[model samples]
Target: MIRWDWIGRNLPEIRELLGDHIVMALLPILLGLLIALPLGLASVRWRRLYQPTVGIMNVVYSLPSLAVFIVLIPITGLAEQATVIVPLTFYALAVLIPSVVDGIASVPTHVRQSAVAMGFGPMRRLLQVDLPIAVPVVLAGVRVATVSSISLVSVGALVGRGGLGYLFIDGWQRQFPTPIVVGIVLILLLALAADGLLVVAQRLLTPWARARSSA
Candidate 1:
């Protein structure tokens, strides 16, 4: 039994929590992209680095998120968003790096030969040819990472940085269900909205991939 009046009274606080949640969730994805691009490119370019790079990221990903938050609290403090953002960024890297390596690998060999024959330099070829071709695969990874990040941000509530996650804690402590239900609903909506936007982005960015698949 939800209390509608309670919800109405708490709208402002909920909005603030949602805003914080969006910031906490999104900043990691953006940061992970910036870091993963170079690491992924290096892994692909060097070949030998891919196994080890991914191995370390996998280990990092496997560590419990709650434990990581506790470990960081001493350094970043209990209330700092960095305690949450730093670990989540690493998690995003774990997923994105593989996607990037695989995406670049999916590029056909003849395409590389064609780029070389056209006298395109390494940088130009990467920007104009390789990355464009890899967008579909990379975006697929982004979609997964984005959803995972949104879901994981709730864990930060345990440390005081979780956005709507605070609602879960509040609801539990007070023996009330409304805040918990509201939190779940809002998180679900955010995840769906984010995923939908990424799908639209994939279509706009890689129209040819859709055409090829349909054919």
Candidate 2:
């Protein structure tokens, strides 16, 4: 209601900022998925490292996002501050790693034994047998991480990284309603859109599970 012209007219800028924030949020989550999947598979293999590694990621994930941004500045510096992507990546481990482990572990022992009996090697068993079965659950974790990162990355703008948070800061200092409203709305929409996409992806990834779930 407060002179809506700024936001109404400047939608393109809002869209760009939202897009960049979403992309930045996603990069870390994707990287986390890459790093987490191997370690999770390894956890099921080595057994000894599972507790320690998962615990560490859990701790990292628990830390405040603001704290992470501040902590990163000392090492990475402001010019390249957007690199808070690393902690965001690390923050995903608690949910993703555990989900990957649980998903693999959930597969009934008989299926694995049957695969091995049919001459599949350990690697093949994982890829063709275990992982396929695990996909449905691992994906759930990825979805959670993806959504959380989307919301959290707005804080990245605090470090001059240029996210929707920039709008938030500008809105506050200038006492303008447009930047604040647009930033909040954009971030919310981005989170919802990402969550919806992950759900669609999960359906695509596990047709059999969907069928079974429906039945």
Candidate 3:
């Protein structure tokens, strides 16, 4: 039950929506990673910060996405991409903070000692030793966050900012399945493509980890 005529006519609109969807999805991921790195580092450095930080993030994560949009509208305004981006950033953080903490934690004690013995200072050790070892775990969390962000960007349609989600609303209003089906298919493909890219990145970035895991 697809309309080739409609699809052909609306190709430009569809491309615009897809571009918006990609931006809405990827921006939060980039922002979340930037924010999560510092926070994650702080949490790992100060042992007591880990639990409360994660607890707070979990609470934020549990908030309904719709509710967040409503709450944010006063500040970010209705139908603004910022409203959508802000909440998705928090959701990404929820998955990523734990991943960051656990990834760094997974670095062996002996490795840290080795770095210290080699005269690698705190920053050097973090850059050269800890983070490199943590890449696989962090990338795993990133994959989850990326997929989640892509899916959640659609919810923004309720606020008039949903990327491809607009198609769903349009289809529903007109009682047509074409736009709805197209939205779903595109979202699925986007998520898969994004996740696949992350998998490739992980392999390239952490070849040693792959060899170790296989062994």
Candidate 4:
């Protein structure tokens, strides 16, 4: 059912599509992280803000991707990729904020007190002590966001920027199984690759955790 010959012949196009897919997925995550960092930090700093902030993020993230794209057409129009990226960014936020909040909360109270006793400023304590310990947990959330965004990017195809979803659309329209199969396989590969890289990065960044586990 797979047209390996077609895939073999179309390596360049497939590569381009894959590249688009990667961008579509990663851009949202980067933007989302930028927006989430401050908000997540604030939420942790002010315990009362956490509930309301997360509620809003959940509502925004719950909106269907396709519906978001459609709603943005009037403002962003269909020409720019913002129509896709914005919604995905919100989705990424929904996941990242919780991860950040939980990660920061998980840091022991003594650690905070010790940092303060050492005369570490709030910013320095947060950046030097708290953030490093939270990396593993935050990175786990990033992994989730990455995979979700990668899969969700295909939904953008309906608005004409589906990346690999283009293959799916074309395959479906032509009743050819190869392109559909190729699209599915490529997306799976992308998700796996992203997750694998995140895992490696987490281990690299948190060597203390690795040492503790090994011991």
Among these predictions, the greatest lDDT belongs to 1
Model 4, 77: alpha-carbon shift in Å? 2.4
lDDT against true structure, model 1 = 0.96
lDDT of 4 by residue, 1-215 (tens): 88789999999999998998898899999998888888999998888999999999889988898999889888877846787888889899999999998888888999989999999999999999999988988998999999999999998888888789889889989999999899999999999999999999999999998899899
* Per-candidate local distance difference test: 0.96, 0.83, 0.95, 0.90
Q: Per-residue CA lDDT of candidate 3, range 9-62, in tens?
A: 999999999999999999999999999999999999998999999999999999
Which regions of candidate 2 deviate over 4 angstroms?
79-81, 213-215
The candidates, ranked best first by lDDT, are: 1, 3, 4, 2
TM-score for candidate 3, please give it: 0.97
Candidate 1 TM-score over all chains jointly: 0.97
**lDDT of model 1, residue 122:** 95
Clash pairs, candidate 1, are none
**Residue 166 CA displacement from its true place in model 1, Å:** 0.4
| RMSD, every candidate, angstroms | 1.1, 1.7, 1.2, 1.1
Per-residue error (Å), model 1, residue 95: 0.4
lDDT of 2 by residue, 42-70 (tens): 99999999999977887787789888778
**Clashes per candidate, residues 3 or more apart or on different chains:** 0, 0, 0, 1
